[model samples]
Target: MDHPHLPGPAARHAPPEHPEGTAHAATLASFDRGLRREARPDGPGCRVERTGRVVRQTGPRHAWNGILWSGLDATNADAVIADQIRHYDALGLDFEWKAYGHDGPADLPARLLAAGFTAEDEETLMVAEAATLPRRIDLPAGVRLVPVTDAAGVRLVTEVHERAFGTDSAHIGRQLFDRLASAPDDVAAVLAMAGDEPVSAARLELYPGTDFAGLWGGGTVASWRGRGLYRALVAYRAGIAASRGHRYVQVDAADTSRPILLRLGFTPLTTTTPYVHAPATVR
Candidate 1:
């Protein structure tokens, strides 16, 4: 779980210490400790590894593989980065290093670029108390929410995803299908169905033993936008998180979704950018 906005697990690792009173810094710190530093595998066949000052997750090629958390500065940053490159390169896996704006040395992103990693879009790490978010899920006319269970339901979810995002969803389809089959309790996948057609979709990932739940892959087909479908999806998942004793629900939100989430009482915590290195691109 590197990039929060992606359809994947939220990054885990204790966040670096921040100065007090820096606009929700304490909550950000808690998020870092619970999600980043203490990251766990999203599903079966995935493993998290802690090597020295870094924590990384490895899985099958279809699954996410990345460095979730790291402790690096000027002295060890370059060496550690090289080590990770070699490690993943040997395995022939393309991986991501999720760097936060608050991460140390203030030049981690630059170092990553120097190491041949390409930077992706930045996203705001947002969190809200599950109790404080809206709980009533009011869908658009002719739309009803359905819980996704079997492969057929997953197909519907992916259909909406592909229409909304305009990208191939096979990778996400595999991840969601496997997660539903193996650890259904850890996740809640929902689709807004209009008759036999899906108009919107989203999922909630519950982190056991932690107070946070992650909301991922919320999207509505173009025809369904601006009709409260997105808001209903958020409320539905936040309510589920609250029922499960999770105090907070977090989202790695993009510019398009940030204002909507902010209107729903979410607080901006920090920003994260993913640096991806393809094994074939460089050694």
Candidate 2:
């Protein structure tokens, strides 16, 4: 999934504004409140917890665990950070602190670093009005989109993931499988297949009651890049989100996807970096 919380598509919200405009600011504020501060669990065995100024999730080891939102500054940033470290440490869980560009104190990333958290690559937080997106993109010949609904489908997605991103997708597989099993309406996964061989894959996460749905894990193998497979995947999931009543689709996009997303009507609101703290044993 794009985030650790449940995801969705749209609501009847105002049209998007320029990135630096007042309406855009309002959109970001709404996102922070609805998608972050008031986040919900993404799948079975996961729970969202709040501790004063922090909103976080604790889940099974195979699930995403992290601080979704926080209101901290010099006054209590360190103490709260320490508390979180101890909290997850006690559970023997490695966790992430998702720090956004607009997050407080001007030194939160540094604080996370000092506390032994390693920051991964930063991604642009982009959003688009779901109804404004194309519902379909003509696929290249021989490539077809398939909806993922079972363990077999999940395996195909993870297989495409491992090849496209060059990263192990065991965790992603577990999470997707669990979500597919227990919360089918909350997520939609799809694969681009070239005559039975998976080439591209992605998923949409629907957050009911919120105006935003999340687009996650769109990756295509190097050989398949530039064939518009990724764009097709985005359009595919946006169709699902819009049909499901979401007003917007959000994505944590890397460089490769950002340009395409921008061209496809997504506006960058901010950047987010995952600051991860591994369990002592792993550290």
Candidate 2: what lDDT?
0.86
TM-score of each: 0.91, 0.93
**Per-residue CA lDDT of candidate 2, range 4-72, in tens?**
322111111122346468868888898999999999998899999999889999999999999999999
Error of 2 at 161 (Å): 0.7
Off by over 4 Å in 2: 1-20
Candidate 2 local lDDT, residue 272:
78
Largest TM-score belongs to which candidate?
A: 2
Candidate 1 lDDT, 1-283, residue by residue in tens: 1223432223323333434457477677777787889988997799999997899998888888999888898999999999999988888899999888678666788788888887777788888999999888887778899999999989998898899988898888899999999999999999999998999999999998888999999999998888999999999999999999999999988878888998999877777778899996454
Instruction: Name the TM-score of candidate 2.
Output: 0.93
